[model samples]
Target chain A: MAASSRRDGGAAGRAKAERSAWVLLTPMCLLMAVAFILPVGLFLLYSFYRFRGGRLEETFTLETYWRFMTDELYLITIYDTLQLAVLATLLCLVISYPLAYAMWRMRSPGLQKLIAFIVFAPVLVSVVVRSYGWTVVLADQGPVNFILTRLGLTSGPVSLVYNMTGTVISLAHVFLPFVVFPILASMLRLDPTLREAAEDLGASWWKTFRSITLPLTLPGVVAGAQICFTLSLGSFVTPAILGGGRVLVLPIQIYTATSDINWPVAAVGGLCLLVMAFIAVVAFGRLSQYSEAV
Target chain B: MAARIARAGRLPAWRHLALGIFTVAAVVFILAPLVIVILTSFSAQSYAIFPPEGYSLRWYANLAAQTTFYVAALRSLILALVATAASLVIGTMTAYALVRYRPRGHSALKAIFLSPVVLPKMVLGVAVFMLVIKIGFYGSSWNLVLTHTLICVPFVIAIVAASLANFDWSLQEAALDLGSKPLPTFLKVILPQISVSVFISGLLAFVTSFDQVETTMFLMRPGESTLPIEMFLYLQRWQDPTIAALSSVLIVFAIFLLVMTSLVLGRRKITTLQTSAEPQP
Candidate 1:
């Protein structure tokens, strides 16, 4: 009889703990419901609403999605957005890999910490500030032009700012720290003994890096790339400040549409952006899994 | 440097030299924009000219005279603080629940919570704007705070969860057995251990919210733009050094934050940085 009562008390305690867990989770659930689910639902709802001339019709239709798919201007905007994201992500990888390799190879703890700090310090600064900084640095009379002119690479100032070159370069810079850290983290997780074994078996440094280190860190590369790609895909400030009224990516298009009170167009553009980001994330997730398996 | 090369294994000397040169180039690439902006802030000429002919404090004086920026900066500060505080509280509760209880489908619930991290900020921004307008809450400050909290809570949850995963629950049980209440036991036992992660998450969340532009733009009135929006708009009209001056101030502020972070993390020397980055299993 005592053992039966004890078992009943244990079951009651387990149930109580579960209740407390739900109680703890209540605020988060409510916040997500009110702020996240509701807003995203309304956003999705607007995409189905019809917009004629200057008025919005509270009706369900696929007109916006159809237009987004059929419109030539939007088709080009989508292409340009993808191009920008891909270019920026590639540039980030190219720069971050070597930098991370150097950090990983460093024997001095002080140097490692300093390098890490330098890479990450930019995160604290506003993106607007960083993007603006890029404009000046890449400007006609900026240091880049100054160096090129002095070196006789060009006879006069080259037009770098307010163009795709400037936009991609700035985006790469903005996301570099993010790209670097993940790669560095993966590098730090490498087994020193594996490299030592490769060395013992007469493998060259480059060969070992290619066969062992690079493949092992490919998951990190994918994670970092995912972040860089998604961020660049939806980037507004840098492209706007640096695009100089020329780059017509989807985010810019959405902003313009919203300003013009074309909610359908804006909503559709946002949905396209969302879909593209989701696709990239899933692709990267697959790539990450494959790399881990390798 | 030679020692570093020697430690890097049997790489050739020329290869090491190449790596060293490339590292210097990469550092320059990272720091050039920031250095140029700081230098430009002192330029006597309004337009950016590398290696300025003369220097002056004119832009700093000009920045001081702009009341709009002052107000916007203040607004951003308060908004970031509120968002950070709210996210920390909500995130901690959720994280503790997930960690301690190991609720069913907990991984799925965690993913749902962290889905915002992958969701494009621009989409979230537009969605929230539509929701607020639809519900006639467009002018309310809580909307902005709530949206920012939503953005920031993921970082807190991710970081705090990772830290809590390593926490010893036996201490909590011991305290409870000693006749302490759950709240006090958590406060006295669990919080002190995870304080460092909490602090780092709070700092990160604050920075994320403060630097928000695409997310906060449509939510605010034209005259009540955040510091970043104000700077963005100002840059569109003018290419002057006044912005450089303001950017320099922000850079200094960033340096201050970096210093504080190092000081705190220096004591702990935890690999929590990596954990914060890849909090998901």
Candidate 2:
């Protein structure tokens, strides 16, 4: 009888705990439902409505999707968005890997900490400020152009700003910290013995890094790439400030469509960005899983 | 280990030299834009040029003469503070429950809560804009507050949950057994333990909210823009050094935050070491 009663008491306590948990979670759930889920749902729904004759029409149709599928301009924008995202992600990986490796291999803790701070301090500044800075640095007669001219790399100031080059450079800079920390963390988490073992087996430094370090850190690389790709796909401020109205990425297109009061086009453009980000996320998730298994 | 590696001579000296040079170049690349902005802010010319021909504080004076930035800054400050306070309270409760109870479908619920992190800010901006307009709540500060809180709460939940997962619940039980009320016990015992995480998360939430532009862009009424939105628009229209001046001020603010965070974290580390040295009960 005593044992049965104790079990019953345990069950009752668990039930009470569950009830309290629900009580605690209620506000957040309500907020998410009303503020996040509902808005996103409405956004998706807006994609089906029609926009014609310079106004939004309250009707259900696939006209927006059809246009996106068939229109050459929209197609080019989609292609450009993907291209930019891929290029920026690749650039970030290339730059961040060597830097992260250097940081990880550093012997001095103080130096490592200072380097980390330098890498991360940019996050606190506004993206607008950073993009504006890039505009100046990449502009004609700017520092980069001045260097090129002084070195006789170019006869005149090359057009770097107001184009894809400027956009990619700035995006890569913005996403650098995001890329570095993940790779650095993975490098730190690696079993130090693996490198030592490879070295003991008379492996060259390059060979050991290739066989041991690189393989283990592939997951971090993929994770960082995932973040950079998604962020670049949806980037607005960098492209807007640096693109000089020449870069026609999806986010910029959406912004234009919305300001033109073309809700359907805006919705469709946003959906394209969303779908692309989702695909990248899933692909990287699979890659990370495979890397872990290896 | 590095010494051993050096002795082994498997790696060529040139390789190290190459890496060191590349690292310095990369750091320069990272810092160049920021340095340029600060330098341009001091330029006498209106246009941004390399190696400014002359220097003056004209842009700083121009920035001070503008009333719009001050108003926008004040608005951003209030909104961020309110949003941070609300998210911290709500997020702490959610994280506590998720960590302690391990209720059914907890992972699913947690993921749903954190889903906003993956959603693009521009998309969220349009989506919430649509909702607010439809509901006739356009231009309301409450709309901005609620939306900012939504974006910030996920970060708070993630940070607070990580800290709470490491919490020793025994102290809470002991407090309860001593006939202390649950709220008071939580305040005295639980909060002190996780205060660092709370403080860090709160700071992060404030920064995220304050620096928000894409989402705040659509939600804000015309002429009532946040500081970032104002700067963004101003940059779009002009390339003068006045924006650079404002940016320098923001950079100084960011540096202040960095210093404050380091101090707090440094103190926390020392306290943790001291606690570890204390005799157990």
Q: What is the TM-score of chain B alone in each candidate?
A: 0.93, 0.90
Residue runs of model 2 more than 4 Å from their true location after superposition: A1-9, B1-10, B267-281
User: Per-residue alpha-carbon lDDT of model 1 for B81-111, expressed as tens digits?
Assistant: 9999999999999999998876678889999
Q: For candidate 1, lDDT tens digit of each residue in A180-231?
A: 8888889888998898788778898889999999999998898899889988
lDDT of model 2 at position B55: 99
* Cα misplacement distance, residue B191 of candidate 1 (Å): 1.3
State candidate 2's DockQ.
0.44
Residue A79 CA displacement from its true place in model 2, Å: 1.1
In angstroms, the error of model 2 at B51 is 1.1
How far in Å is the alpha carbon of B101 misplaced in model 2?
0.7
Whole-model Cα lDDT of every candidate shown, in order:
0.88, 0.86
Best prediction by TM-score = 1
> Candidate 2: deviation at residue A42, Å?
1.3
